[model samples]
Target: MVAPPIVTLLASLVHPAAGVLVGLGIGVAGGVALLVQTGTQPPLAPARSAASPARERLPLGLVGIVAVFATIGGVFGSFNVAAIATAEASGAGAASGLLLSAYSIGSVLTGVVVGAARLPGGPRSRFLVAGAVFGVVVPVLVLAGSLPVLIALAFVAGLATSPLLITGSSLVESIAPRRRLTEALAWPPTGVALGATAGSTLSGLAVEALGPQSGFLVTAGSAALGAVLTLATVLFLRGRAASADAGSTR
Candidate 1:
């Protein structure tokens, strides 16, 4: 979400290829920082042997989580280049960063709020929040006559998207078994990346074949699909809870 705009800004001052290089450099730097930070964390308690995978069935709830996250990531990633291209079509290509910057600002604010105040409806509900808002906002980009409107809605998009990323990651900590936690935590991001790759391809082609305005349709459609996937997640969790309760009663 944040990387695209920063790169675009660099692109305008330098060249398009430079923008891509800078974004990759920032990503590598961030990865290194993340590794350093994780390495510094205190050691965890011993893993629970009960979490051994031989006897356990993969929880459908976790599968559902991966599906939703991947769906959301694809839609969100589609906008990475599509949004800038749309802005370019509007003759705001030079200032495309403004749209993405506002989106990041919104995400930052939401991060603070989510940290301070517990958002109602829990982690799974974030899918609904993100899907609905992004679905609506992306389609409306076609109607935006100026960059300011795009920026405003882009900020709103940030607010919508941050929760899906934050809450989905948070849920992994609670739902994954102690022994499998590291591997379990990985699925969401892996799904997200794969979906994003797909989205980038889909959106890029849409823009080239159709027009900049048509590119937003990719976002709108994908986001709507994400919202629908949330129902699967909800139902899976409910069924899991019921099964657990039934087992307990025995």
Candidate 2:
């Protein structure tokens, strides 16, 4: 939430490169702080015996979750480029900072609420709803004519983001085997990185070829794909559970 405003301030006061350097510095400091908190870390898991089952491959459901996260990341990447282009076209380049801040604030607020509340549904069901909401909200960004409108839509889009991400990670924890947990968890973030790169590159090209609004189309499409993948994953899991129950009866 704070990064955008701070980066914007530093960029305006110094140079854009300086702002980026400061952001990197802050990230490094955070890492250092975490590393120094060794006493707060959880105890290491017990070593597995040689006779234990070989490390299982990741489930298809977990791969679907990673894909959903990738689509979400694409939405974020496309929104960043589109927001900047739209703000610049409106002769208010600084407004992009506000737009991004609004997005971050919305996510933070929703995350807090979601953390405290006992939402009524399984992770998969909630994830499906969140994905659908995200997909539905992103396309409306293209209709934003004013700064406030754009910011509002950005915030709304952000509202669904936290739930989607939280549920995705939770689903990873639930679906992955203990032996493969670390590896499985890593894939979602990797997916996000890959998707962000693709989204930024594609959206940049789209904005250059068409207009600022065209970038939102990329986000909308990605979000829609995420929703579809989430549905398929839910169905796949249900089928797997049903098959397991039948086998157990036999």
Candidate 3:
């Protein structure tokens, strides 16, 4: 979250190479710390027994979750390009870091509150609402006339992000089969990576052809698509739950 501003400041004070090296060092340190916590890691599940064969196909609900996550990643990628362009147009290229920081801060604060609070409704409902809000907020970015207003809107747009992401993960955990849990969990991140690449490329083109504001349209469209996909998958998720309940009753 704070990394963008810190890296930008470092780049301005030192050099771009210095900023990259510092970021790499921090990432390495964090990886090392995670590696050192091996003792606390959960034990791997035992191999499947002959009576319980591994499923070859993934659940439809899981695919929807991945698609939604991809949309979120699209927002992030498009915002990155739009923020830099907006800041440059305003004659303050470094201000892009501040904009990105505002977005991150909003997400972090919301995530903290969500983690501490016992929110009402099931994960699917919450995810739907979050996705809708995300869709609605992103289009407003096109209306931002000043840097300050853009920053504020960016923060507002970020408020829905954490809930959407956290709920998506929870849904994945609940829906995925135990045998392929690790592989299922990985799909969401893979979707995000693919979406980010596409978003960045398309947004760059939009910004170049139209303007920075047009870049936001890509994010808005992605968000709307995510919300629709979530809505469409609700029935599939409910069916999964119903099947699970029936199995348990037996």
The best candidate by TM-score is 2
Best by lDDT: 2
Off by over 4 Å in 3: 44-52, 55-58, 242-250
In angstroms, give how far residue 160 of model 3 lies from its true place. Answer: 1.8
For 102-127, candidate 2 gives per-residue lDDT tens digits of 88888888988987788888877887
Q: Could you tell me which 10 consecutive residues in candidate 1 have the lowest summed lDDT? A: 51-60
Model 2 lDDT vs. the true structure?
0.83
lDDT of candidate model 1 versus the reference:
0.72
RMSD of each: 3.3, 2.0, 2.6
Q: Kindly report which residue stretches of model 1 are placed more than 4 angstroms away from their true locations once superposed.
A: 15-17, 27-58, 121-139
**Model 1 Cα displacement at 77 (Å)?**
2.6
Q: Write the per-residue lDDT of candidate 1 for residues 8-57, one digit (tens) a residue.
A: 78778888699888777888999989887966565775565876546444
Q: How close to the true structure is residue 72 of candidate 2, measured as C-alpha lDDT?
A: 80
- Per-residue error for 178 in candidate 3, Å, reads 4.0
Tell me the tens digit of each residue's lDDT in model 3 across 98-151. Answer: 888888888888888986788788877877777777777767788888999999
